[model samples]
Target: MTLCLSLLFLFTIQPSHSITTTTAYAADNSLQRVKARGKIVMATSPDYPPYEFQVSKNGKSEVVGMDVDIMKQVAKDLGVKLVVKSMSFSNVLVAVETGKADVAMSGINPTPERRQSVDFSEIYYNGGQSFLINKTDAGKYTSKASLAHKIIGAQTGTLQYNLAKSKIPGAQVKGMDKNTDLVLALKTHKIDALGIETPSAEAYVKNDPDLKMIKSGYSLNKNDTGSAMALKKGSGTLVAAINKSITKIKAKGLPNQYLAQAGKYMKVNTHNTSMFHYWTYFAKGIEYTLLISAISVIFGVLLGTILALMRFSKSKIFHAISIAYVEFVRGTPLMVQVMFVYFGIGIVVNLPALLSGIIAVSLNSGAYVEEIIRGGINSVDKGQTEASASLGLAKTDTMRFVVLPQALKNIWPALGNEFVSLVKESSIVSIIGVTDLIYQLNIVRADTYRGVMPVFVAMIIYFVMTFILTRVLNYFEGRMKHAK
Candidate 1:
């Protein structure tokens, strides 16, 4: 039976691979022909507020700041409708390459490795890498030479990461996916400094009173200019159109205009602000946290049911295997499990990051729920099963009709508890770059350099969501019990 299942899996995977290859090729071809249509889709990361974040007043998306303005002008020059799709920074590159987007217009640098897959337009911005260090330690690292043998943090898959590793050869550089993590690391003194973009570092210094940029300006090599607007290779029409728009924007001085607008909402000067802005940013993060929690809970409940049935089987071998599965899942930490499933399994499987997060949370929650279900099933009186047997009912029907209904009524509260636990556990999925609530809060706190607000907001949001869900579950359990 195992061999047959393995063969079936192999057959299933073969078709999937073929389909993926075909889809990739088709996307590439479609992008090449996009000039025939008058629409250019540009992908940007919306989490980077003041650059490309979504404003949620009336549910209509209005792009703001230098990057958004530049892309819109570029689209107008091409005589195409400009559609901005908000996604994570990493996914932005994939969107461009897959022809889902004509260009990516976040503050993406033109790395040589990226050149192999996509073409870049002229450099729009010229900021280089700099470090944000604790105010007390600011004087310790005066230059790149001084940074040698020190530890620094940077956002992963960035030019800052590359420059930090290369410039300070002896320095220990840790690459984090979220900007908030780098700030947290600095706040906790986990790292000596944070290697960041000049604009981001400037923003951090403005909001964070305890942190300051090193006086000695550290930067990437002059050749490695910070630029934007990445296009897929062979998209000559799109490239030409974007270049013309950039030239026009430069001549008209639109970049400076956009910067001035962005400066209004963001701190332009290096000074602390009232605590009001901090809480506002924190409220923004709550929206994302609730989203991740809700999705994880739904998936976890579905997966738990499957796991319970497997554990309840009559076969001794199945029972032993199920016991091991429960032990393995419960024994490990949720954070480590999230990382393994998202980054580790992601390397082998071709699932989207969000889908991977759901699968991981569900699988983990299912293990505990299995034991809950088994205990509930066992609670059903032995006489009930004996009565079913005397009535000539099969073992499956006896359990399905008599045992399961009673067991479910007893276990309903336990299931609700498991769901509440799953909501909290889902926070770990942020490690794999899902833009869920904790992840969004981290960005807000990092950018604002005020951690208290975002943390508070996240806590309140989680508490409220769990409270509501628990109440609903209790109501259902009561109804079920009364019906019985």
Candidate 2:
């Protein structure tokens, strides 16, 4: 509760909007910093084709698209290497503003709302807007107007989303984080149509015969249609350099060349869209998931034990501190905590994404474990502690030898459940570009355009993993009972 209150107090006192406005032009040397670092990190959501998407080349996964091509040129011009970071579309701009990436470029439109938080390079490509629908519904819904009072889908935090909510009369707007998920929703008839940029809708139409596209038909501003790279506010020098690169590329008509290259890669992805074909992607995801779960479990136990002990301490300060931490963590969602640790504490120290994820999960799990351990300690017969005291055992010795061992035995099942939960919840790390199972699943979905299959595969894999862990835990429970 104390921790939660403190965080809430901080936000209440210094709102993010006010902070953004004040810090928007805080003497940025983003270009100089990039040159010194020798590499420019570009954050993107790799699910939007022609703009940014993932492709597997020679059995190795790679992010490729028109945005990538442009960033590559920008990097070359600046005499630096280009490093791409894949995350959700919503996190792309936050990544730049929070220093996770040098720039964000994933079919991003520079709307006024986005401009307030981040700067954008010159408009590189304007693909316009369109809606994707079932080919059978094409005749019924020829334009955006025909779809009024119907369910419309758009990517959350995009121009299409805003337009759908404001322009479409009586329309139900369903916003999702990924275009792939929106396409799935459209295919399943969960949404009547999906509002998307024309190039992406065209890519989907070309790739999937069941899909069709229609012009949005709304009078749009140039800013609403064009894609641009977003950078931290006050990055004047970096933005200027990138704009120069954009000028050269536009002058040379390189967007057409890049789009053609992206088309070929998309064809390759669709050539073998089988789930079995992308086993390596899933394999890597499983590996990272297990690594994160294992590390978090070890640290969670350590942190939980300390916090639980603190709660029992006679010192008011220690007890208050422990209470604050436990209450705060339990009150908040793990997703928010993950982002806070990754992007908030990140301002003080640059923690790697995987490490940040583990820390957040461990911290979150600790609160739960602390409560569980407290219950177990209470469950231990008070007579046992009394006997320990009668035996001349110190309080610490009693906790370590007499009470703790029995408490752990009583709480073994609860601890096992926590460990299993960690395996599933660790998927949240994907938002920070950690290649966990969920992240890889989304990548496969985007690459294959076979969304449901990847989802089913991931579900099965998770069940198998949790099943094995449960059996292992039951085995230990049996052994402990036998010993008793």
Candidate 3:
């Protein structure tokens, strides 16, 4: 079974390989495989500035930082093309472990548990831990004992996450997928403080005056892994290639030079902040959010209508299938379905993120809409169907001409409510990388480091979207009511 699965993975996951330019002395053979595929894939979470972050250049966006520069040289030396994939930071190590990426280089530090799953390149940038808090709560984290009961936020699978759990005995340590989330949680006081890297803390403080580091409370850990590149386990040749590239880059002091270059791309000006700089982000978010919601609703209603009819059928098999589908979908959470389709099934079919999210959302929404539709059909007067039958009309025509139309009229309000609910719930798809409202705001919050304002804007956008959609649907329902 294991060998069969391995063969299947190789055939499916790894693209067609045309070997070229590989040397014979490479023992690990990862470099040879990469050469055969003709590309080295780098997986990163581009929210970490000065390491990896999105920057707009000449009306286009690109990921740039020290890690990117280092990995470009690695690809250059290996004689392969380079490809980059951005995802949540929590998924990077897993992507390498599962062979989703050849290497992950998003300011990740090694931990003992991570060492068991993947190999690490030599340490690159060494930095300490720091705490960020609202300026008004500057000294709230005076000491370790004082922070025992406070809630602290950190990026999941990081040294800061571990430190927060171990150092602060009674503090509630909430782990999120990105640094920007932790910072936003810090800004809005969701978490009493956030544990961030010293350099990242400095970046945030530099960009926004509302954020300040509590110096006395910040300390270095003996077990700190510093920053390093992660690769699939046992990829000895790839690790060596990356370390050699890192060594050369450092020997020429290119890391610091890269850091200086990245600084020039930061658009945030602490002296002059305005809405003109961020309108495009919220605008794009609104566009995609509406698109996802509209597509999901249309597909959902059509699918739901089918399921409802199956439930009404005389065939037991159809009824059983409809019942099972509705029960299974409604029993599970949307987030789980979204991830399973995006990352789990995505591996098998190579599904795109938008399609995966739409599938998940429609499947989830169909279950509830199925129930609404079924109830609506059942609520129609039995006499209506019997009257159509008395007039010699068939069941299909009876439903189409008389009963279903009336049933639909009865369920229009319910369907509109479901559509509204879906528009709001669509935010969950951002987890699987839809690049909708929430995802864009995360980058904006990190770029500006003025977390509350961007989040506030997102909240308003959501409200405006839902409100306008609700009003439009209500008007349609009124017209429908009067049409009869």
Candidate 4:
């Protein structure tokens, strides 16, 4: 009784909105929800330093920087607590568009594509584009005429990417997911230079002696390039409220003060830079990765069974539908499926990010599982079915007692491979804001600002996970064989 009451109270409770807060949720408005909950949920990418990045103190991790400072002030002006949800820069806008978060801020620039999806506030700060290149050849190629056929990198889905494509006419433009990867890419000459925001470019130069920002060439257009908070379309009440906060802060010149304070702690070695020290990140990553893989596979088995049975059905309709599902799922990339599931179906059903990711993965895996199970059933000899029928068994009983058990035993190893594949493919979920092991590695990469090494460690962690899971599956297979 006590536990039930506690659980009920936890879910039902909502804090009283301050009388000073004018935003009311009479119709469950976004602003009213924030005030009534006494917390504003913000989505950001913490890898962008001086704007937002991770900080470690006494072995605990927290996000801190200029963007966070501004949001904190915004929360204060609205008389609410701020709750931040960190994710990929691409997904940050998705979170806002889906109403999963109240606002999105991470040094995000206003672009036409983004403007079509979400509303932006009055620009908080402006920055032109710049490049961080290798120190060995910093001044070797300044003129656009001399820059032909060089490789340049930028973070995907950002203003810098567009700038790289337009500004450098003859260069190979590489768009990476994380800024740290681009940093490493530049230092190693995987790319000749990296286009990035001015602040991050400066931070990279300041943190490492091997990096230098090229400022004399390629003056990037600053139009629609200012950072701003993002909210859902048609969210004028919240926008106006946040704008009021932005106005107050700019009046006090708080943005400059925040930037100066963030710069003071922006040095790389000022905090824990050791991968061994942040074992919690890897451990949690492995835990969630395995859990998502296992849950996804388990659900895949159930869904696959249905799909397989449909393929075996005599009805052309069920068979066509199953075939179409399998081909479409196999044909499309998992990344696209993840986006549609999260943004399209998720918005309609209002699913959380992790659940949406799991469902997407399960649906993708199920299509393949269907083929595996169907082949296994077909591989069973006709004699087995005849023997079961001769024993006076019904069709369903024959399938259950004779066909499925033998089919499972025959394809156990193939099924094991499917499970193993799901574990690796599960990494795709990280892009959609699932904080599995790979995402944590990016967090560590951004925090330490050492790009390649973190990836090397993540590679080892993934190998270990797949290896252990394979062995566990093998063990279960051996036991099942012995029992049979």
List TM-score per model, in order: 0.72, 0.95, 0.86, 0.88
**Tens digits of per-residue lDDT for model 1 on 1-484?**
3235435433432323333434544455433455577787778765554465433224332445568877777767766777776555666776565445678887788888776667788777766667888899766776667878899898788887877887786989998866666788888999988887666676667666798886325544554556767876655555665677787888888877776676564543113433354444445445545666677666665666666777777777877877877888889888656645543444345456577777778778878878888889989999999999999999989988999899989888888888787777777766555666776665555445555666777788788988998899988987997893
Best by TM-score: 2
lDDT values of the candidates?
0.69, 0.90, 0.78, 0.81
Predicted structure 2: lDDT = 0.90
The residue ranges of model 4 lying beyond 4 angstroms of the native Cα positions read 1-33, 57-59, 142-149, 216-223, 268-270, 315-317, 479-484
Q: What is the Cα-based lDDT of residue 12 in candidate 2?
A: 30
Each model's total of backbone clashes: 2, 1, 0, 0
RMSD of each: 6.5, 2.6, 5.1, 7.4
Runs of candidate 1 with Cα error greater than 4 angstroms are 1-39, 47-63, 97-100, 215-223, 232-236, 251-253, 267-383, 394-396, 409-414, 426-436, 467-484
Best-to-worst ranking by lDDT: 2, 4, 3, 1
Winner of 1 and 3 under lDDT: 3
Number of the candidate with higher lDDT, 3 or 4 = 4
Which residue pairs in candidate 4 collide?
none
Rank order by TM-score, top first? 2, 4, 3, 1
Q: Which regions of candidate 2 deviate over 4 angstroms?
A: 1-26
**Model 3 lDDT per residue over 298-400, tens place:** 8999999999999999999999999999998888889877866666664566676788888889889999999999999999999999899999999999988
